[model samples]
Target: MDKETEQLIEKAGKVYSENFSMTTCFERAIFFSWWCGINDCGFCFMSALPKEKTAKETAIRHESSILAETWLCRKLGWEFGFFTGGINAFNADKIESMLEKINKVYGEKVWISLGPIPKKLLERYKPYVKGVVGSVETINEDVHKKACPSKPINPYLKMFETANEIGMKTAMTLIIGLGETKDDFDKLVNFIKKYHISKIHIYGLIPHKGTVYSDADIPSAEYQAWWIAKTRIEFPRIDIQCGIWSDRIERTSLLLKAGANSISKLPVFRKFGTKISYDLEEQTKLAGREFLGSLTKMPEIDFDEIDRFGFDEELTVKIKDKIKKYLNVMKKN
Candidate 1:
């Protein structure tokens, strides 16, 4: 709110425009594979320890949904699948089959970030995935251990090193307002610098029922904006994405101005039939940026590129027919 801080944030905004050549905070699509995982994270809202509760929804999911969702992401003019949750040793076969099929169509537009996978296991995914994520909520080891008792930070560091070594893009996830101090922020920047990390997905802690911090306060819009701008100022070329949570949806536009290139987790797959965050859309407009916030208006469908991949006839036809029908309905509307 002060002049100096305001001016710095403005500078960060300019850096984004200068580097990316766009004021648009593009809405990237990221849906989950949430089914089975050891939910030892006190801050986690989804999934549980296997024996603690049901632990997950189910291991077996419709594989066809993978192709359909990937196509849907393309139709909406967004990035390919970035999956998280599930895909563990217990139920790797079914998930691997789906991702393998996805690789043939979408190629390297995928990344998975639920947790660290061993070097051998991660390499296998390298063929289909373009990037991998290491969750580094805080560089302060004390804070990290207290917050995530079961999750270790060193493996994520190793994961980053391996990902870079193997010629894959390296990304990270960090939750703001995890009781991290100002010094921890500096450590975070240093960690990124050391690892040559490319992208960061910043999440605000939103308390959820049945979690340890269910009554925790969500980070303020101003705090979120300040940190994001600081990160952008430090790493102008780094890909920064601020999360938009429904709980604190009011912070939407301010977050964009803080130098996040996109509101990267929009549940955009739901934008097909279900309504999207029109409020967040309004916020983007307020920030003078564009995002796909409605299904009524559609982007130009690139059929040639779609056909060029030589995907299965059955899957291809299914997606195309769906698109055609949707387009027709849009035309009528």
Candidate 2:
């Protein structure tokens, strides 16, 4: 990173420390409710996903698996159940049913990322969810339309508007390397001003194979930090989550300094198995922030936390047994 961006990041860190205090929480748990849904987003990897894995053509992840993933995420100390899937007709009802079950078990730990549902549906989910999030990737109408083709920015803004009107917290996800303009960033500020979005998730776009930009360059980490820092400088109070995968968890320290309060996509699996190199707690601790759960270490399956973060006694026993077996099996491996 350049000196100027470094200074800005430092400034953002100070602002974050002053306003929110520096605590990084791995609160996001992305449960892919469906997969391989057809999308017009030229940059998305789903477009390249095979027919069998795609939602519209083949099968979606089972509801049991979906619920299991949520339970495991909550148990692993993630704070929100972020339900996202490919665009399809069957998604709405299935998501509503899953939300009902999750609401009963986890109580307002839901956030839906399914694209552009009706206003009434958003209202229906209010009782079951903490908030709703959408990818308002960019407010550059023409840029969004040209790249997404079918998925425009307005519909997501409408969803966000409904979320705000219904008193649910709102967040928008934006990709940094998608030909975003300076004016686009300016519009994002106005967008948060207009819609009152409480959080913004930023990622550097990594071009996917079989897509139009398959051969495009990946945005450097410094570029990612630049935008994240800029955002923190702009909205010092807004929650900023820097997107990371299992491979790049070490970036947690850098992002924390760049003013990101959280990072994305922990290594939690459907059956609660994780395969990763970085130690999440240590990484966040080195960043001078705290992580909510032990990322690599499994705790003693405490009953108190089970009641607080997991399901009822019967289900908890089943889950606990499974976890123990899984750990033992890993030990042998």
Candidate 3:
């Protein structure tokens, strides 16, 4: 076995030794916030901080804004909170300041999901953050840049390196409908085997209203479930979970059965986190109603529908070809 594999096995042994539930103790994405515009990834959510026109002007100051966000999370009764943002957009000062405000206001109730960060930054935030999620988004750099105009912000491979050096349990996100072939996805999954990534979040491409890849075809449930299952076997010790897999609950449940253990529920809507600034309760309620409606419609788990997504001929052929190529490449290398 390779040195990485050997280490992973040792780590897994140490991990499974604990009594944490693979499913129950698995964390949830209580409040998710990002700091950039749509990248190459299908999702287009960004942060709500200072910038040019792209940024939203808030009534509150930065530190207070952060404290408010944390307080809202506590009030909403979320276990963990995620701070998703562009790697380039965040700085050590901003992170440090944010953490201090959060800790001072909310104490130690929520976790932060700071995106790909530097080793020093990670160490600085180590005490405040419960965990980190340096999602390379996609392993393919070409696809990554094309999707995220912020090229070089969160380079796919550099994230893995930083995660290892930081000595923090990490999380990754995969965009399933980013035009990657079966081989590409498999290669990425196999590549992820060499990290301290404790969670794998799978998000189907949700065409934002305005973005380059909005109209692209989203991956089928069958494709994602198979990928999740295959990944579970390949990286048996890792934690896997569906991220924003709301559109395909059946497939998501199949993935959960295969090995995924975490889910990111919808965040309660607030004017502070929206695209506009308004103190009017009516406007807030209007947005809140829409947001709550969307959250309520999230798909429920259905095992029977998942079972119907049988391994058809096309998928079987694709998966087999990819697996064979993977093995051959590994042998050659």
Candidate 4:
């Protein structure tokens, strides 16, 4: 590892030693996007689609990059790593081959956050992955369609459903501040409950300069805190995550207090010609929280026992009622 990465690991270890005992759900992990391809999702600002590469060439590059990231994750002592990128009609055979290679070489410590994937392809890829994330961004179909015109919400939902059915650890991401209302959030909570999703990543939109929603309003820290608290209460056992995009120290600290337990895509090493990102560790320190290493084992989830509001109907009603009351108060103020 380079000097910078070494220093980061040491600092993270110190933070972990100091804070791990006090927290119940404070874990951290890193992610890499091998092919930062062009996404038709109009809300993205960070996409840089490769123009000159062929499908086979792109597949090779992505596999090699993922292997390197796996090595870095192991060296840095992170317990989990993620493969993320834009939606492309990638060759299923090539993608599966790459995933199989990564699993064989690095073990099942990697997860993927690719957008919508076909059910057959997803099933073929399931055993090679630790988890699969199909981020719905928001539960409001209108907002979702408007934000991601090229990508429909139904396919994303199907991806999650299929992953769950295949016994693949499933996760989702919801972006706050995208014109979604409290009712939308409630719908998201209900969907997660219905699916028994293993993890949920909540991010506030960071309008990039080139994105269609560049001039969009950022959600308030207070609103984010409220949302996080609501999600925690609604899904008490699920791993709620905050990302580097929402890494302001005070804001992150508030999120932790509000029941967020993990931070994802922590920059441990530089790749894809981007600068080394270490905001997660710094944020953890500023939050005065422990930096628990990446996920070691999948949390045991009893899918059969998880009631789709049958067992927790009263709790669900109470939480939604509380959220409605709180939103009313905010509106009044």
Per-candidate TM-score against the hidden true structure: 0.82, 0.84, 0.61, 0.69
TM-score result, candidate 1: 0.82
lDDT of 4 by residue, 68-131 (tens): 4443344334555356654553566766765765565455656777777778877788777878
User: Higher-TM-score candidate among 3 and 4?
Assistant: 4
Q: Rate the local accuracy (lDDT) of all candidates.
A: 0.68, 0.69, 0.49, 0.58
lDDT by residue for model 3 over 148-220, one digit each (tens)? 5554544435655775676656677777777666678666666676666666777667666556765777777
Model 1 lDDT tens row, 206-253: 676777777788888777888888899999999888886645657877
lDDT of 2 by residue, 228-319 (tens): 88888888889888877655666668788888887775544321334452365667888788667645655454545445644556766655
For residue 11, give model 4's deviation from the true position in Å.
30
TM-score of 3: 0.61
Cα misplacement distance, residue 186 of candidate 4 (Å)? 1.4
Model 4: lDDT equals 0.58
Error of 4 at 59 (Å): 10
Order of quality (TM-score): 2, 1, 4, 3
Backbone atom clashes (below 3 Å) for every candidate = 0, 2, 9, 1
Q: Which is better, 1 or 4, measured by TM-score?
A: 1
